[model samples]
Target chain A: MSSPLYELGEPVLRATGLSKLYARRSSDTRARLGEVAGRVLFGRPPKEIQSLRKHEFWALKDISCELHQGEALGIIGLNGSGKTTFLRILAGQILPDGGEVWINGSSAAMIDLQAGFQASASGQENIFLRAAALGFTRAQTEHRLNEIIEFSELGDAIAAPMSSYSSGMKMRLAFSVMAIVEPDVLFIDEVLAVGDFRFRQKCLARIREMRERSAFVFVSHGMGDIALFCDRVIVLHKGKIHFEGPPKEAIEIYESLDEPASAVDTPAQLTKAMGPTFTNSGALKDVAHFWCDESGAPVTNIAFSDNVHLSLEFTSTVDIKRLILGVPVWNLNAHYTTGLSTQLASEELSVRTGERLKFLLEIRGGIANPGTLKSMMTILDGAEFLYRNPNPDLVIENAGHPTWGVVTIPHQWNLIERQ
Target chain B: MTEKLLNTRKERAKGVRIYRPDSRIRQNGLQAVISISREIRNFRSHITTLFTSDFRKGYRGTVLGIFWNFVLPMVPISVYIMLVSLRIMPRYEGLSPAVYISFNVTIWFLLTGLIRQPIQVVKSKNTEMMKTAIPLSAAIVSSFAQLCFDTFVRIALVVVIILAMQAATKWTALFIVPIILSASIFCLGLGLLLSILNVIYRDIERVITILLQYGIFLSGVIFPLASLGPLVSLSAANPFNVFISSAREAAFAGSISQPGALAAWTVVGVILFLYSAWFFYLMEYRIRGSSE
Candidate 1:
């Protein structure tokens, strides 16, 4: 392990002032174009470049990190926080606009599990193609062919075209071939969560073996893995590195700011806390519910990249004052990222008795790696901590019950065997 | 975390020295050649892989795999020849219908192959090629490798057809080289522009598809360039036409040493290649960034 480190120099990979920008949703631009086009046929409407209105947001901004040989750099961020983007840039799969990614040795980036594989070719054929793409020659690949194939456990499927295999099997084949090349810098992006548990364990062991020679940059939401394998962890907010340090410390800060109280366990109780924005059915009297006999299982497996719909029913007797409506996610171990609230300075809380408040929460990728998560609903008065438990109370009160944390982060897996 | 990991690289190389974005790597001649040559050498092992992969993919999931590349265009082409020679030729020129039609359409297919495929070959493979620091030239060369294989198959068919015509194409017919060069350079020039545009608007692909369709008809595929006359000749002077005409000249009459036209085309091809290559290098950073 130490031998590989010395060959790769003081640091294997260095990124300075790296930034990546992705175009925003083009729907708004399309909608505007439609209006302009419609007016063009009818009479006249002001016209502008449709693409100009296209939103552009930087996924990684001024991201700087030095990954030394044989060390693990763990990256954690909210969904869309650009963990994979950084890895790809380092791999030379993409270039950065603001700065440079200088590396001392060859690098293999595993941004997409399926990136280099030749889809129409067999797993065996793809292995050669993929390895060659990473800078290996025929002699080298021929020598390692058996080793790479054995690790994939593709069995007889190695002879079949890759399209015939399941996505997991394809991902496994891709990862194994790239790993065979022994690049100085290896980038693994949340691939550990792809297959079943047994397979994940096998792949992790292979990754550990590879670590004997290569420095790895890993991205995942699960803090446990960071704590277990990472030499250091960098936490990102939006697109900037908000915190960087030891895995233990970074995960601590991340979880502390990430987890919030749940709104479900006491949904029946939330009808009573009577914070703000409570109407007959929902705030501003805009939500509808079809309950009684028709109850869908509330999507309870919530992760970071889910849109949460929180609903509360209550009967307000007196006019409620400044009420704050919010749902917070609390980690299985109780840490908070931040608290989001539904307090519009424009909308006043003017609900009388017997009303309800409902809102939706949209979650993005890269927030958390992956694992068990929980959330809570709070209806507070003035400045207070109110964890709603379904206890019936009148006016500023009613029983609260847990609604749903239906969104889940997929834990895809890949397994490898020793050759 | 320790402060040792955060050090930056320096700018040491003067003009023309091989650059290391990571300044620690000495900018010496041997290092650059050894590495870039390794990159170039890596493509040799890949030629077989790319050729086989391309040959396989061109007909994947469908029956008659590699045979399609050899025979797919031959059918409609043969049909068009039969239609025009037996029916339309007596109305135009006084040549043998089958001989003229076969000679003309075969040349058309070769030229169309160059134009249709090479457009933005770089961008189509952007996701795969951009993954490594392999020289940008490597991607274009690989696509050309695929094209060369396809061209070889077509040439075999052309030779058999030309021999059957009993028309011995003389050495002057070698204009096929310059014509292919014209089509290649022009397409490469256009390919670079479109590869850049593709990162922004994928619709350019649809637009190119349309251009090739119209271009195929305009370049005298179904009919002879003679019917279009001086206007057509001027159009034939167009790079794509020169590519096809050069081939047709070699395979058909074998009278192709058009020094003036070849010289003129050589100038144009060189200028276009340089302009496109320079533009690509100038925008290299931006284009790579834009793809993601």
Candidate 2:
């Protein structure tokens, strides 16, 4: 959706060499005391004059970007990568430690959707309250009242107190009010996934319409939404820009970055495994977990379009009657992409003591959503989980896929002459 | 957020806002005055909304609604009047014992209300400050307006009592106007400073609350500190005593006991108000940082 106004090259928002410094928690008390003493003696603190100080680390360093009219810029990064900090600086919530931000026209931020709604007040009264909080006059807010009510789809419920409304209804009201008050520049931070599926689609369409008039700085972790809304993307890593280019290429780079070791979904206490020593009913220890090709040779990497198999080996200490193996794969975002289970495949087997059992699970269609995926194996007896690998063993590597979602299906597209 | 109030040549030419490191709003006292005036003028509507909403929200579910503001102050004044009628308290300021105690307790409530309510007002609006760019001055002014409204209601009740008791009226009673204004400005200045500090160290709130619980006894409002002999000079030095004692002397008697102190403390009030406003302007960023 690249309109001609996007080619006008008129920069509406610009940031250059922005940085923020935060004192370490251990030294924060001493620094705060010094700051208070300085303020008491001399009007302003010396820290404001000389920004850099010891025991302080940069949250964002030397980040520069420019957004033109009718363009949506996406910022993608893992948690604690300074994405929110950067957005707050741009939105004028906090001043930067270094560098400057220039806005050519009016701006608004959707950093927090439900920022200033009074619970004791009725929804109709709160519209005026929220509008005043946004620095709009009562007359101006009144002009858009009907439209906001309609967009929120809260016909009779608008007269009810805000405290009585459910959380989803509150979110609907907040999103509708913010959407109606259009500004020249809009800074949105991961607020798109609001309400249910149908309402989320409505919000996306509304955002698309607003893109024609306002320049946007969008931050989100969902790659699909980024590809849909942003014309270009910036990938940040550890308070630095790792890559900046088209959305597809930026997504690839973001996926290829190594997942942090202490990522979510790992168990709290990991049981160290020396090797496979399964008591069948007591526990199942994994010796090796890997991916193999059609010829059954272990491979470190697998392509999304290739045929592959996942193999696991274990040695049993006792005879097992009914065993179930379940493997679940999780993407870097901790989103469960896909799973495979032996019970679903209807394969029943028994293992005896001192027998080394090898289970081979064939991938009929290769796993999609290219990235390094983490998979953990679970051994169950009916509804009871006998053993679970505390640490994910199988790491699936699929790099540089063009598609943008978690699953891919083969289909054909043809144009029929029915019309 | 004060950067938006800079509203200079750049703002007039289509609202091009610029944010940079250490963008101070004031370079001098005149600039600080100008910036505050500009902020007040620009956000007057926001100030009105916030004030009305605050007044309404305080007594939302009650049957009496805003009348509570009128009746709540009467409870304490009624207790003081009962004590005066019971002969437990002696006459103060050479007037009728009941009238004197009524005026003293009413003025006392006005003094404490101005100085104490601001910490609660500004602290509760901390969330509103973080989420919106509504100028901090607007919130403070709204708080000042609500307190003024409550004070006016109580002052009206005191005026009625003065008429009903048929107390001797003096031409010097007009002096109470400036005395009340001086007290308001002085307490506002003190309140503004305490509210900001309370955000940084909440201990200020707990300590101020405890001190205020006993402040009435020590401020010469209910008891005549001068008759205590030893506390005479201390009472004269206290601004709370200066304002309340000056108002009593001017209203009932035609002359003031300590006119020079009243005039000097009025100047101090002006200077304190100016200094505290400037300090609040400069420490805006630090206050916002610590509030979260």
Number of residue pairs clashing in candidate 2, backbone atoms closer than 3 angstroms, sequence gap of 3 or more or interchain: 0
Q: What's the DockQ of model 1?
A: 0.21
Task: Please give, for residues A1-419, the per-residue lDDT of candidate 2 as tens digits.
Answer: 23333564588888998887766663463356346534642565335435556676788988999988888899998877789889988888776767888888888888778876878877887777777767778898889999889988889999888999998888888888888767888998888878889998999999888888888899998888888888888998888899988888888888777667665445322222112223344455545666776776887667666766877787766566777887776665556666778887567777776778787878755446566555666676666665655323334445454565666666678988776
Please provide, for model 2 over B141-240, each residue's C-alpha lDDT reduced to its tens digit, 9 standing for 90 to 100.
8877876786677677677888887888799999998899998878877777777777766778889888877777777777778766888878668888
Model 1 segments beyond 4 Å from truth? A1-9, A26-54, A259-419, B1-41, B58-66, B88-107, B120-124, B128-143, B201-208, B229-237, B250-258, B281-285, B288-292
Per-candidate clash tally: 58, 0
Quality class of the docking in candidate 1, CAPRI style: incorrect
Q: How high is each candidate's TM-score?
A: 0.67, 0.85
Point out where model 2 deviates above 4 Å: A1-5, A23-37, A48-57, A258-263, A266-278, A281-289, A293-303, A312-361, A364-366, A371-392, A397-406, A411-418, B1-14
Candidate 1 overall lDDT versus native: 0.59
For candidate 1 chain B, the 10 contiguous residues with the lowest summed lDDT are B11-20
lDDT of 1 at A376: 46
